[model samples]
Target: MVSKVKIYVSGRGQFAVQVAEALVEARHHVVGVASPRLRDGHSDESQAMSWDRLRAWAYPRNITWTDSSELRAHHIAADVDIILAAHSHAFIGRRTRARARVATIGYHPSLLPLHRGRDAIRWTIRDGDKVTGGTVYHLTEHTDGGPIAAQEHVLVPPGSTAQSLWREHLAPLGIRLLLRVVDDLAGGRRIEVPQDEELATWEPSMDSPPLFKPELIALPGSVSVDSSKWALHGQEGRDHSRPGSTA
Candidate 1:
């Protein structure tokens, strides 16, 4: 039987919204959302878009929300069962994470230890790796180096671009894995598998110039997904990775 789990979700974009929606659909209590500020229309394109999507979804549903800055400063609810970081750019401070009843977790779209950076999808395409995967891992001080809770692999088909790969495989794959882990946690399963440091790999930031030639890009005026190395769902940072950084 699945117990009602109280959750605090922090992140940006449609991915984060979907995660929140999935949890609620599963009958979980979503205590609050920490998203980028929408009112400050003076932010970057990505932040602005994130705020818009998050605001539109959260407001109508009456989900309590605060800007990421406030989230970093305050204590998370004492009753929160989990803290889920999805495609978030801001870091959820340790004090906040400590309040979760179970654990704080985040999603990354690579077979971690392999692609431990902001732009795993782009790097995977550049490296030409035939197999890559998604991981739902515990949040730690290390970037994407936390112990694994659950992971599943996805194949990179021929002629796969970062955009196609995410749309066709990684995005949905992340949602599936994340929900599965949430279910496991609610069922009293302890699924922490420490990653092997020896096998770990780190790619350069998404800001770096692309090594892959003629990179497939989104058409102008279309909903932008992958631009240069930037991913549609994640933002770049030292303490974070795709779908976003750890809590």
Candidate 2:
């Protein structure tokens, strides 16, 4: 039988709730959940899994929930085994990571060693990449620099948007990857593979300037291609179309 571990979840949005649900379904003890309160202008998915709704769901299941913008080490229980950061914007301190008995893992929308920053899905689409994926990795002080635990790739359909990619591909794949990683940990297995720093590429944050200017390519018969080939002049630009760009 797989041993159940004590887990603390920190994040907001549908992804976080999905992870928490999966943990509970796996019979893991969810000690606490720290998430931001719902606000206007939040994404539809996030609003669907707001703190208040999660609290109601969790309370009935005997899971403690807290509404906090950030999760600190002090917020965690003494016997917490793992801390899972799912779709969280808050930066987890090194001290908090150390507090966990097993590890503090994070879910990244892009494959590690590439697109290691905020708005990974947006960047992938902006770059017009043919493929993209998700990564479940150990969390460190450095952003998305932690060693990888599990990864899965999906082909980016032509004219795919960030929202579509996330909803259709990355989100589902990420959940499965996270569950597999948790199972590995539960089975007393170390599953970290060191990331190659030399091959790493960092994308601009979500609030940064647009990565590429869309160019409408006239294709045969009423079909047009939204190509990301036209680089926005006067910005730090890199050719993401090159090989090894996506997962």
* Candidate No. with top TM-score: 1
Report the C-alpha displacement of residue 69, candidate 1, in angstroms: 3.6
How far is each candidate from the true structure, as Cα RMSD in Å?
9.3, 9.9
Q: What is the TM-score of each candidate against the true structure?
A: 0.80, 0.77
Pairs that collide, model 1 = 87-243
Candidate no. 2 TM-score: 0.77
Q: How many clashes in each candidate?
A: 1, 0
Residue 71 lDDT, candidate 1, scale 0-100: 71
Local distance difference test values of all predictions, in order: 0.72, 0.68
The candidate that achieves the highest lDDT relative to the unseen native structure: 1
Clashing pairs in 2: none
